[model samples]
Target chain A: MSGCDQCALAGVLPPAPTADPGRPRLIAIVGPPNSGKSTLFNRLTGLRQKVANYPGVTVEKRLGRARLEDGHEVALVDLPGIYSLSPRSEDEQVAHDVLAGTMPDFPRPDAVLLILDSTNLGRHLMLAAPILALGLPTMIVLNMADDLRKRGGEVDAESLTKQLGAPVVLASAAQDQGLEPVWRFLTECGAAPSPVDLPALQDVPRCHAWAARLGRHAAYQPPAPPIWTRRLDSILLHALWGPVIFCLVVVVVFQSIFSWARPLMNGVQWLIAWSGAWVGSLVPNTWARSLLVDGVWTGVGSVLVFLPQILLLFLFIGILEDSGYLARAALIADRTMARVGLQGKSFIPLLSAYACAVPAVLATRTIENQRDRIATILVAPFMTCAARLPVYTLIIAAFLPERPVLGPLLGTRAAAMLGLYALGFLAAFATARVLKSSILKSERTPFVLEMPPYRRPTLASLGLRLLDRAKIFLRRAGTVILAMAVVLWIVAHLPLSAGKVPPIERSLAGTLGRTVEPVIRPLGFNWKIGVGLITSLAAREVIVGTLGTIYGMEPDAKSRGLQAALRSDLTPGGAVALLVFFAFAMQCMSTIAVVRRETGSWKWPLVQFSYMTTLAWCGAFLANRIVTALA
Target chain B: MQANVIRRRAPASLAELRKGEQGILDRLDLPEDVSRRLMELGFVPGSPVVAALSAPGGDPRVFRVDGSEIALRHDTAVRLKLRPAASAAAN
Candidate 1:
C-alpha cells in the first residue's frame, strides 16, 4: 500500500449503516463487570486458538477456530468487555470500533454473541437492541445460569428466543454448560428476523407492543437467594457494617502475606542457599562459583523469596474479583474515586501495580477508555512494586529502629514493614494527584460500571493465573535482569590493579558514573553509588545486587550481602541517602518498555522516566544534605 | 394499584421493568442526593428509561436513558417512578 493509503487504513473509521440490512445472525454478549465474558470466551474457543494482540495494538484480541458439528470452520474473536457501544475508554473503543468497523483495520464479525446474565436479563437486553439495529446476525447468551440454580431463578430460554426474535441459550461458562447449543445456533442459522415482539428503537411505549407480541418472555421469575448468600451479603454490603467488614477482610489478606506464607518463603530461601552451597563446594575458585553463588543466588534468589506472598496476594484478589465483592468494594470507594477524577475501575490497576506493573498495565485492557488507561499507566509506577520490597526491608531495618508500640503489645518488626509500605502508598497517592492535574490532563471518564453477581472462585483458574505471573517474573529474570546484571558486573569487576588503578574507576561503569557524578552528587551519592544507579537500568532490584558486588559485599565477598556491608562500609547518613534514592528512582528499563508499548508512543515513557529520575535525584540529595547537617 | 396502572402491577421501580421494557418515567421517590445524581446521568423524572441488562445477581439493573447506558442498584431502581405503555399494560 502507498504511504497515504496505509495512513488512511490505519485510521479506519467505524461504518454507520443508514438503513437496516435484513437481520443478520449476530450474537452479542452484554453484561456487568465480572459477568464472565472471558470465561465464556475461553469456553467458546477452548484452547482452539491463541490470544494475540491486534496487529499494532497492545489490546489483546482472542482468536479461535470453531468447527460446526456439521463441520464448517468459523473464525471467532472475543471482544473486550464493554458497558455499551458508546466508547468512553480505550478498551470500549476497541470493542465499539471493531463492531462498528470505525477503524479500517478491525473487521466486523459476521455474527455477534450478546451475552446476558440470566438473573439480570431485563437490564442486559438494552445493549442487545442497539446491536440488533446494526442489522447483523445476533443471539443472546444468558450467562451465569448456575447462579440462578443456587438463587431459585429460572429463565425460559425457548420462550425468550421467541420473544427476542433470536435464540437465547442459558449457559454457565464457569461450569461449562449450555455452551454447545449457543455455538451450534451461531454457526448454523444467523439471528432470527427482527420481530415486533421486543421493544422498538424509540423512547416511548414500544415495550408494550413488543411485550404483547412476545407473551410470557417477561413473565419469568428470578430464584430467591440462598440463605448463606443472603446472610453474607447483608453484612458484606450493609450500610454501616459493610465498610468495617471490608476493612477487616483487607487486613486479614495483608496479614496472610507475613504469616501464612512464612513456611513457603522459608523453604524457597533454604533451597536457594543449599543449591548455592552445593555449587560453591563443587567449583572452588572458578567463575562458575561466583556466577552461581554471588550472581544468581543472591540476585535472583532474593526475588524468589517473596513468591509465596505474591501468589497469596493474587489468590485473594482473584477470589475477591470472582465473588463479585470487588464491585461492591468499588461501589463503596466510588464516591471517593469520583472526587479524584478517577473511576472505580482505576482501583484495579492501581492495586495490581503494587505487586508489579507489567500485568497491571495489561489489565488496563479491561478499562474501556483510552484516556483513563493512559492516566492509570502514568500513575502505576508510583505504587511500590514487589521488586522494591528487599530495598525497603533493608532500609527500614537499618534506619527505623524497632520500637515498642501499643504499650508493648505489637511486634516492632511487623510495624516497621507496614509503615514502609504505607509511606510508598502515600507517595503514590500524592503523585497521582499531581500527574492527574498536570502532565496527564485527559478528561476523566464517568464511572458507569456493572456489578456482576457473586460466585465461588475456581481454584484451577486461580492457580493458573498465579502460575502465569510466576512465569513472567522468571522470564524477566532470565532475560532482561540476568543479562543486565552480568553486563553490569563485568563492567564493575574487570582488570583489577594492585593499588595502580581502582577496578571500577578504570572500567566502563566507573567512567559513566563519573560523567554523571557531578549531577548526582547533590543527591548525596558518590561516583560508586552513581554507577550503581546506572547499572540498575534493567530493574529496580538490580541496583541493590549491583551495589553489593561493586562494594565487595557479594555472596563471595566474605561478608553478608549489601545491606550488612553498607552499615559497616558507609556512615549512617550515607545508608539513609541510598534508601531515599531507591524510593524515588525509575530504574526499571522493562517497566519503561511496557509503558511505551501501552501508550503506543515514546513520548509518555520518556516523560515518565524523566520526571521520576529527577524526583529521585532531588529526594536523595535533600535527604542526604539534611542528614549530614543534623549529624 | 390504580385503574390506570400501566403494565403488570404498574412497575413500582425501574427494576420491575423487564429488559426491552420502554416507558415514560412518571416520578422519582429517590432521596435528593440520588435524584440529583440520576438527573446528571440523564435519568430525570420524565426522561424515558429502557431497562437494558441485569447483572449476574440482578441488583444493579442497567438502563439506557437519553443516549447513555448506566447501571443502578436494584433497590435504588425501585424508587424510580415509571408508567408502562398502554398496550403492554393491556397484556
Candidate 2:
C-alpha cells in the first residue's frame, strides 16, 4: 500500500487474519508530558497488566494484554513520555534507547501510537517527527479532541493523516471515545512506511519548518488560556500570598486525606481484621495458624490498611495536576527553590515524595538538568512519605494528649496530627539543606517548565490516574514488601526456644537486635526496637506490625493501641529519640533502589545511605540527651 | 561585516568565548543539553547577560544572564563563557 494511503488506513480494521499468530503485537504509546498518553494507555489496558522491570533494568516497564473486539490479544507497553527522540535527560534517554532497541532487555515495538493533543497539534507533533523518522510502523492518536472542539477548533483528521503520512485516530481518553478504532489500528498495522526520515543532527530551522508544514496540514492552533486559569493565576500566582496559599493547599490536602479517608480506612481495617481472624479459626495447628495469621494476613493487612489514605491523597494530587495547578505551583516556587539548590521542577517530585518517594524519584526523569536531577534524588528521600505515616501517627498519638486546642474550634487529635505533619516537613527541609551542602554540593540547576493551560479536571481522568498509582504501589508491596514481611516474621518468630524468660527475649529477632544493641544504645533503642527498625525498612507501616510481633500482641493487635504500647514500653526520653531518628531517616528501601536506578550510579544511593544515617544518629542523640535532662 | 559583528554574530563556536567578559545574547544556539532547561526558565532568544559574579565563600555563584538572574557553580560556568562585544552592541 502507498505510505500516504497507509496513513488513512490507520485506526481502520484490516481483513480477517488468515493465520493463527501466537505472538503478540507490541504497541507503544508516546507523546509529550500531560498530553493524555497515560490516559489512553489506561483506557486500552485496564486491569489485565503486569509491571515488569524492563527485563533487567530498574525502569518500570508496563506490559498489558489488551483483547481486541475480535478476541485477539496484543501487548501494549506504556513508555515514559518524551518531547522528542533527541533526548536530553536520563528518562528521555531511556525512552530513546528503548525505542531504538538500544537497551539490551527492552523489546522493539511493532507499532507506535504517537498521541497528540489536537489543540496543540504542532508542538505535540514535534515529538512525532523524530519517532516517525525512526522508520517504525506508526499511527497518530489525536487525544483531547473534545477539548479542541470546546475551543472552536477542528482538526481535519483525514487530511492531516495524509499530510503526516500516518493514520490518525481522534480520541478523548476521559470520554472513552475512539478506543475501539485505536485498538484496531494498533493490531492491524505492521511494517508501515517511513513518513519523514529527517536526520538527527538537522538544526532547529529545519525542525521548525517541518513542524510548521505539519501544523498547516493539521490546521493546528493552541487554544488561548481559559478565563478561569487567568482568574486563578491572579491569586494563586500572586508573589507574596502564593507561597502562603501553597502551604494552605498542602495543609488542606493532608487534612482532607485524613478526614475523608477515615470511614474507608476503618472499613478496610475491619475487613482485613475479620478475614485474618476467620483464617486463624479455620487453621488446625498453632504454628500453621500463626504463620497464616501473622505472616501472610498481617503483612498484606498492614499494607492494605493504608489503601484509603493513599487513594485519597493521590486523588487530590491527580485533580491538581490534571487541572494544571501543579504547573503554576512550580512557577510560584521557582525562585524559592533556586535559593535552596533546587529548581522549581524539584517541587513536584518533592511534593509527590510526601505521598510516596518511589514514584517521586521516578518522576525526576522529567527534570532535564543533570545537576538538578541528582540533587532532587538526594533530597527526595528526606521528604516524609506515606510510609512514615504510621511512625508519625503513633508518635504523635503517644506524646501529645488529646487536649482541646482553640477550644471548640478544632479536635485535639486533629491538631496534634497537624503539628506532627509540620514537624515532618521541617525535618525534611533541614535534611535537604544538610545534604545539599555535603554530598550534593552542586549549584542549583536552572530550569524551564511548561505551564499547561488549566481545564476542569474530569472525574474519569482523575479516577484513572489514582487507580494507576495505587496499582503501582500495591504491586511493589506485593513482591518486595511481601518477601520482606515473611523474612521478618521468621526473624521475629523463630528457633523454638523453650522455658523462655519473656517470649520476645527468646525470639530470633531479639537475638539479632541484641547483637546490634551496642551500636544503637546511644539512641536509646533496645533490641526489640532495633528489630522493628530493620523490618520497617521494607515499608514503613510494617513498623507497627513489627512492634506488634515484638510485644507478643495478636495479629489484630488493637487491644493495646500502638500508641499506648510505645508509651508504656519506651522511656519518655527513648520515645523522643526514636521520633527524632525516624524523622531524619531513609526508612524505605524501595525509594533507595529507585534512586540508584534513576541516577544510574551507586554513588547517590551510597551518599544518601551514609548521610541520612549520620543525621538520624546525631538528631536522635541530641533529642535523647535533651529529653533526659528535662526529665 | 556589520559594525557590531561581535555581538550580533551567533556564537559560531563556544570556543571563542572567555570568562568574565559580557556580551549581548545575539543568538542563543542552545545545545540540546541546555535548551529544554532554558526554555523552562522563561529564557528566550532575546534575553540579556552580564559579567559573572564570583561566589562568596563556598556558595554557588550568581549570574545576571538571560534577563532573569540565575545561579551556577564555577564548574558549570567554565562550560559557558562570554565573547567580547563590539562597543555599539552595549545595551
Considering every candidate listed, which one attains the maximal DockQ? Answer: 1
Q: Model 1, which residues run further than 4 Å from truth?
A: A1-34, A47-59, A64-75, A101-108, A146-156, A159-165, A186-230, A265-307, A335-377, A392-422, A438-444, A467-479, A482-502, A554-573, A593-603, B1-91
Q: What do the candidate models score in CA lDDT, each in turn? A: 0.63, 0.66
For model 2, the superposed segments whose C-alpha errors exceed 4 Å read A1-21, A52-60, A154-163, A168-184, A194-201, A217-228, A238-248, A348-426, A434-445, A498-502, A531-575, A588-607, A625-631, B1-26, B29-32, B36-91
| Weakest ten-residue segment in model 2 chain B by summed lDDT | B52-61
Question: Number of clashes in model 1?
Answer: 47
Chain A TM-score compared with the true chain A, each model in order: 0.78, 0.80
How many steric clashes between backbone atoms does each model show? 47, 4
Candidate 1 residue A327 C-alpha distance from true site, Å? 1.3
Q: Compared with the true structure, what per-residue lDDT tens digits does model 1 show for residues A413-441?
A: 56755655676566666776666677655
Model 2: per-residue lDDT, tens digit, A1-631? 2233333433242322233356687777888777788778878888776665554334557678788888888888888766666665555777887777677855667778888777666556656666776556788888988877776667677776676577877888878877677877866875554454332323443454456576676676655434565466557665566668888887777676657777888899899889999988999957778778878787767767767777776777677777877766655655567667676668777776776677677657556566767778777777777667667667666766777788888767677556556766776666556656776665433344555667788776677667766876777668766776687677767777673223766777788788888988888888878887787776676777778766656423233465676777787778778877887788777776667666666777888878787888888888898988899
